[model samples]
Target: MNDLGFTDEEIERYARHITLPQVGGIGQRKLINSKVLVIGAGGLGSPLLLYLAAAGVGTIGIIDDDKVELSNLQRQIIHTNDNIKIHKTDSAKKAILDINPNVNVITYKERFSFKNAEDIVSKFDIVADGSDNFGTRFLANDVCYLKNKTLVSAAILRFEGQISSYSAHKGSNCCYRCLWPEPPPKGLIASCGEAGVFGALAGSIGSIQAIEVLKEILGIGHSLNNYLVIFDTLSSEMRKVKINKDNNCKLCGSKPTITSITNHKDYR
Candidate 1:
């Protein structure tokens, strides 16, 4: 058994994790006591959820109102054809528990919005945004800033993807709003369903997102703090660009303005 009450099976299963110098017995315990909330159960969420659970994150909360569809299986590796029509959260929970029953899976079968975002996010230590829409992404960022929680955000489209982390603890780092003060005009953005993302693109970015979360929880390694890491799957190239916290950022600005989590009308 591990330091955090992991069973013999868990020890064997997570042996790879425990053996790492950066993540030894102490890190394993941290993971066992850590609580991470994932904001979606689709594409990006699939790999993030599976790896986090398999790594033995003590408590995992999945917030998604979507159901598994046959088409989703093409990129969403967690769900299966047999799970079509099943709630995405339910399907993810089953898959995670099947891999490691030690994990505690919490499901929010409703969409995350300004109304419930605070409450849902407050219950976990770290928040990972795998939601596809801008509204939910902004809501998650605002809630994370308000709760002073570490937020690991990632987005995948076509052959490109980006990942970053925002936290007050990281010393004046930028939040999602700092990068995109406003969502792209509607029709300017297209979902994977329409634009078509390479299957491995989401996997690559999502897995990096999971690593960011693990590093945050274990308090180890350099994270994508105050910078955005962009991956181009087609060219097999990656770039990191520095990002500064806007002095007038709505969320984390010096003059600080946005006091409430109000829905941005433009998102609709």
Candidate 2:
């Protein structure tokens, strides 16, 4: 084993990470000890999962109810044409294992629902949201906020994408709901399916999400908490804007109206 209890194989696999001053043997150990959950196995989830696995994150939990589709190959690089009919969770688990045998992957072939969110989110040290829908995204944020887990959230559409980390439990840091009190009107927003997204754009945002997850695990550098990163690949513009927590935020605020997953008591 290496000085940090890493096996000789692990040390060799993560040689670069172990040599970095910010993420030396100590940080590498933290990563191995970390259990991270990734929501969705398409688009943003693809690159994030691959990178996390390659980074040697020991335990990874992936939840995805859908099956891979021919269209998904455009951006979901974790899966190949052979996995078109397979469940996303299964496809992702296979890819992750192929990249890093040391990683223990847990595959859940189901969507993230209130019934399962708590049990799943509670087990992981950190959560990453790569889901495409507002419902799933909001659910993840609320659950993470309530469970006091750090959340790395991101979304992509057309040539633009946004990313942010939330840990309202840390105080001053904003939860996803803190910035978006509620989901936008259904018709007002167009999903990747409806509006179409640039495949590589998803990679950009998902990579950022993966970087944030690693930072949270290593506790290095300034986090994305309370900062919203917006990227417009079309214009090649990137902006980092501050997000202030809403005092009346239903989930993470001075007085939270969302305490339980079920029955969602809206005190507002």
Best by TM-score: 2
- What shift in Å separates residue 91 of candidate 2 from its native position after superposition? 0.9
lDDT of candidate 2 vs native? Answer: 0.90
Residue 139 accuracy (lDDT) in model 2:
88
Cα lDDT of candidate 1 equals: 0.88
Tell me the spans in candidate 1 whose CA falls farther than 4 Å from its real position: 1-6
- Model 2 scores worst on lDDT over the 10 consecutive residues at 259-268
List residue ranges in candidate 2 displaced over 4 A.
Answer: 263-268
Please write out the lDDT profile of model 2 over residues 88-202, one tens digit for every residue: 9988999998889899999899878888999999999999999888888888888887898999999999899999999988968788887888888777889789999999998
Inter-residue clash pairs, candidate 2:
none
- All models, RMSD in angstroms: 1.5, 2.0
lDDT of 1 by residue, 38-137 (tens): 9999989999999999899999999999899988988999999989999999999999999888899999999898778888888999999998888888
TM accuracy, model 2: 0.97
TM-score of each: 0.95, 0.97
What are the lDDT scores of the predictions, listed in order? Answer: 0.88, 0.90
The true-versus-predicted C-alpha distance at residue 161 of model 2, in Å, is 0.4
